[model samples]
Target: MKLLKERIMRDGKCFEGGILKVDSFINHQMDPILMKSIAVEFVRRFASTDINKIITIEASGIAPAIMTGYLLELPVVFAKKKKPVTMENMLTTTVYSFTKNRNYDICVSKDFLRKGDHVLFIDDFLANGNAAKGIIDLVNQAGATLAGMGFIIEKAFQHGGEYLRNAGVRVESLAIIDSLDNCEIKIR
Candidate 1:
């Protein structure tokens, strides 16, 4: 976690609307070594549990989820941002993106998730927690058990982490930004 915090301080940028632009190493462009380290941490964090699968939203969360699945030796499933014509049997839910400033639907095939699965949700960032909530809904619809949720970065200034925790969701975040005041990203 210290390594992640140091990397964020070195490479992260603070944008408008409290956005921490970590695209250089996280969402957009990626650092495989860094991701692997993060994955190892996730594996350690959830090692005692019986995790059958890893679920994440599309685009940004894919990389971390894949690395986590590989390390955990579990299958990884992601929710698609757009439903394709080829896919008919799917479970869908709406998630609001604070960064994008819009609400959109995310979809996943019903076949991938089952009633008894212990799913661990992985993502690159956690701000509004809507996307995670939507993914949780998909798991709920399948009657699957949610083992926990993990994130590379969490905007603690926002209510995302607290909301999920209050709901009894086990949330693990490597770096939590408590504040972004004075053009500085403060972490806890």
Candidate 2:
């Protein structure tokens, strides 16, 4: 975790709207060694649990999810941002994104999750916790067990982390950014 915090200080980019762009090594052009290290860290964090699946949102979360899923030997499922007009599911819910400033629907195939299966949610960032909530809702609809949510790097300066924690969710973040002053990382 110290390694991740140091790397974020060195390479993370702070943009407008409190978004930290980690495109240099995460979110865009990825560093495999760093990613594998993250997987190892996550494995260490959840070693005692019976995690049957890894669920994450698309784009940035894909890399970490894949690595962790491979490490855990579980199938990784990403919730699609847009549900096809023709897609069919008796169960569906909507989540509003504060970052994008819009509301969108996310769907999970009914076949992926089964009752009592533990699923660990993984994502790149936790700005407002909308994505995490969305995934939790889908898991509930399927009657599956909610294991925990894992974040690669969290901006603790924001309320996303607290929101989920307050809702009684087990949240694990590799690096917590206490501040991003003048684009420099401050770890907490």
Candidate 3:
């Protein structure tokens, strides 16, 4: 987590409107070593939880989730933003993308997510908790138990972290940005 915070300070780009672009390393173009380190940290953080499957939204969350799943030796399932034609008996939910500024119908196959599954949700970022809420809905629809949620970066100023925590969700964020006001990155 310390490594992540330092990397964010060095390479993360701060834009107006509370946007922190970490594409240089974290999301778009990835650093495998750093990602491995992050996966290790996540494994350590949630070692005690009973997790059978790892869930993440497609696109950015895939890398970290895969790494974490590999380390944990657990199956990883990513919810597709666009439901494929072949996908059947799927659990679907709507999620608003903070970055894209649009709603996406995210879904997963019922074969992948099912009742009695203890799942851990992983994602690239958490700002408004919309995606997280969507994941929760999908998990609930499947009758699966959401064990925890992991995030690479969390904008604390947005209060998503507070909302999830207050709702009794175990949320872990490696780098928490206290503020991204006036194109400045402040880490908490």
Off by over 4 Å in 2: 85-87
Choose the strongest candidate by lDDT: 3
User: Which residue pairs collide, candidate 3?
Assistant: none
Q: 88, model 1: CA deviation in Å?
A: 1.2
lDDT, candidate 3, 1-188, per-residue tens: 78999999999999988889999998899999999899998999898999999999989999999999999999999999998988678888998877798888999999999999999999999999999999999999999999999999999998888999999999999989999888989998
Candidate 3 lands at a TM-score of 0.98
* Candidate 2 local lDDT, 106-134, one digit each (tens): 78778776787799998888867888888
Q: Which stretches of candidate 1 lie over 4 Å from their true place?
A: none
Candidate 1's TM-score reads 0.98
lDDT of 1 by residue, 73-168 (tens): 889998999998999989999998776889999999989988999999999988889998998899999999999999999998888999999999
Model 2, position 43: C-alpha lDDT score: 89
* TM-scores of the candidates in the order shown: 0.98, 0.92, 0.98
Model 2 pairs in collision: none
Candidate 3 stretches greater than 4 Å from native: none
